[model samples]
Target: EPEVTQTPSHQVTQMGQEVILRCVPISNHLYFYWYRQILGQKVEFLVSFYNNEISEKSEIFDDQFSVERPDGSNFTLKIRSTKLEDSAMYFCASSLTPGGEGEQYFGPGTRLTVT
Candidate 1:
């Protein structure tokens, strides 16, 4: 089966800096999402994107966070200003349909370490 892939599996950045994590989801999927796990916490939804617009976002997806599809095959999550609490394992997920009804496939993850 095809799988989602992410670049720079590990990232370290200083507080207040900007970072962009990149992902390439399965070619045929339609819905994409960004989620994060803070240390030992449960996975938290950050944002969801579909058809070039945001579908939904959680409280955690503040103005500092953004998602984009710069090209048909690439999806990205940008953190404009990193905070210590922003450190987490960021995951990229995709599905054939909206997440509530379809199975989402997740990438390995990009571990962000904000200092």
Candidate 2:
């Protein structure tokens, strides 16, 4: 099976700033998603994209968060502004199907540190 890959394994930024986290999902997968896990907390869904458009998003994914498939092989998550509370590990995921049961394959993750 193919897997997701993410770059910059770790990212550190100042509060109120912006950051872009990158990922490359399995080439044949049709669905992509972004999820975050604050230190010591459960993983939380941020958004999902399909067919070059957003399929669903969580409340935590406010106007500040945006996702796009810039090209055939790259998917990205942009946080318009950073907040201290946003410090967490951001995981990029992909699925052969919708997020059903345990079907999503995740990347190693990029740890975001907002100061």
Candidate 3:
């Protein structure tokens, strides 16, 4: 079966540098999203993208963050400038639709550590 794949399971970056987290979502899915979890916090939605535009986004998706589908199979999240508080597990997810009960499949997650 196909699954979401993430790269660089762990990354340590300086507080002012840029970082790009990569993910390959399940093939044939139409919706994609990014979520983050602080060490002991709940998963928080960042942004949802579909049809090449943002469908919905949370307050957490500020100007420092951007996402792109660089190709047919690769989805990437770029943080222009990192901050210490940006440390967290970033998860990539995909679903068939954005509905009340849409089930999203998640990647293993990329643990980002900023210092």
Q: TM-scores across all candidates?
A: 0.98, 0.96, 0.97
When sorted by TM-score, best at the front, the candidate numbers are 1, 3, 2
**Candidate 1 wrong stretches, greater than 4 Å:** none
Model 2: what TM-score? 0.96
Model 2 misplaced stretches (Cα beyond 4 Å): none
Instruction: Specify the highest-TM-score model's number.
Output: 1
**Taking the tens digit of each residue's C-alpha lDDT, what string does model 3 give over 1-115?**
8899999899999999999999999999999999999999999999998988888889999999999998999999999999999999999999887744689999999999999
Lowest summed-lDDT stretch of 10 residues in model 1? 95-104
How well does candidate 1 score on lDDT at residue 81? Answer: 95
Cα RMSDs, all models? 0.5, 1.1, 0.8
In candidate 3, stretches whose alpha carbon ends up further than 4 angstroms from where it belongs are none
lDDT of 1 by residue, 1-115 (tens): 7999998799999999999999999999999999999998999999999999999999999999999999999999999999999999999999999978989999999999999
Candidate lDDT (C-alpha), each: 0.97, 0.95, 0.94
